[model samples]
Target: MRSCKDYSAKIPNVKPALCEAAQLQDSKARSVLGRPIWSRDVQAQGAPLRVLVLGGIHGDEMSSSSLVFHWIALAQTPPSDTPVPISWRFIPTLNPDGMFAKPARRVNARGVDLNRNFPTPNWARDARHYWEERTRRDPRRWPGTQPLSEPESRFLLEQIDNFKPNLIVSVHAPYGVLDFDGPSVPPSRLGRLYLDQVGIFPGSLGNYGGIHKGVPVVTIELPSASRTPQEAEMRQMWMDLLRWTTERLGSSASTTPASPDLPKSP
Candidate 1:
């Protein structure tokens, strides 16, 4: 993984202080090129709710990773007024290899789109068909040889199984819209982006986690791939999320009952 200093040069709007403050831990997972994928767990007083926020699944989305770093800084100081205490796990730069590539491509070193490599239902049939037909075999959107074929995607699956987050927030960019999948009522808006229920893809995290796994997955597509929204905007989005989470998932009286198909996605 790159040092904080390196991040300053690579990612737009990211200062070295932001990376250092995130205090990311080694996830013990690596990309195809052996770059460490880091994770950080932030707490808000008690074990009330759990949220998993992921960014940089696509390397070219520099702003996505930057936003995660900024959120980490914000998460460090939990608001005293908030009622729900959250156990937040953040995976910043899930595709470090792609982020650090010569020109920062969207796929991994093996040229697989990790976003399209989740083990969703009927991945072999649907993923391939989507790639060949729907996407017209777009190389950047390749679903890989099979679902969970790459180490990155497998690590994410393990995180989902182990973390069992009540909600999953996956960040991406340049689309400027918010998407929701799973059991609860979705947030109408986060900052400037409003709820836009884009149809699910065959092997997307939103599809697998939100639809298949039954977890509420909030997908944020920022307005720019390289430029992060203003600091105030990002903070507003965070606060909005906190409010929605507290309303929608505050009652953690019942933890997910585990089974092959017991609890569900994103």
Candidate 2:
């Protein structure tokens, strides 16, 4: 495993101060327009709880990306004096090309919905029909020609394999609910802001991480997709997330190794 100090030296465009000396890995995969996908891993001694936070799988959901950037900024100057016991990895804006485009598209430049492009077990059989029938052939939810066909989705899968986070928090928008998969994560005080729990979709990250890999996935559907949350709201969400991880999921003495039996595209 690469140390934080090693990452600082090897990875370009990552400031040591911003990440607090965390290990950074730039995915070899790129968006259709060639935007690099970046992930920062904050390591802890012994076996630490691993948490992966993702935002902006859908480029149109600006708030998701904004909140992630806000979290990264906050990480530069953490509020609490006590150190967090978890190993945190943040991936801000996986679909940068789409995000940067005019009017911000929901899919990547290739028109593939990165979120629905994961290589789930039933991807081949269900993805097309689900996108066609359930979503009514909505271009926004297109699952691509095949699973992991898009570079962005492939990059995310690689990150999942490398990071092996016990918990995955993917931020989405306009739904205003907290949808969970894998093991049960009971609603907390903060969960009142997002009281509803939605079902999983075919070839989604939730299905890939939670159902297939046995990793817990918390899908935070923000109230709005157009605008970022207020500073107070964002901070509150962050605090709540920290509380949820520590309180709900018991702390561990050692970190578990990355699962080698992850699904792969044939």
The candidate that achieves the highest lDDT relative to the unseen native structure: 1
The list of candidate 2 runs beyond 4 A from truth reads 1-25, 76-84, 189-192, 252-266
- What lDDT is obtained when candidate 1 is compared to the true structure? 0.88
lDDT of 2 by residue, 1-266 (tens): 33333323332233355445333466456788886676665544443567888988998887786667667665545555434466667887788777777768889999999889998897889999998889899998899999999888888887788777878889888778888888756544343466466778889999999999988898888888876667788778877877777666645424454432222211
Give, for candidate 1, the lowest lDDT window spanning 10 residues: 257-266
Q: Which portions of model 1 show Cα errors greater than 4 Å? A: 252-266
Q: Write out the backbone clash pairs for model 1.
A: 209-265, 209-266, 210-265, 210-266, 213-264, 213-265, 214-264, 214-265, 215-264, 215-265
Cα RMSDs, all models = 4.2, 6.8
Tens-digit lDDT string for candidate 1 (1-266): 36677777888888887888787787878888898888888854445678899999999999999999999898889788987777788998899899999999999999999999998989998999989998889999998999999999999999888877889999999999999999999999999999999989989999999999999999999999999999999999999999999888987524432222112110
What clash pairs does model 2 have? 47-254, 47-255
The lDDT per prediction is 0.88, 0.72
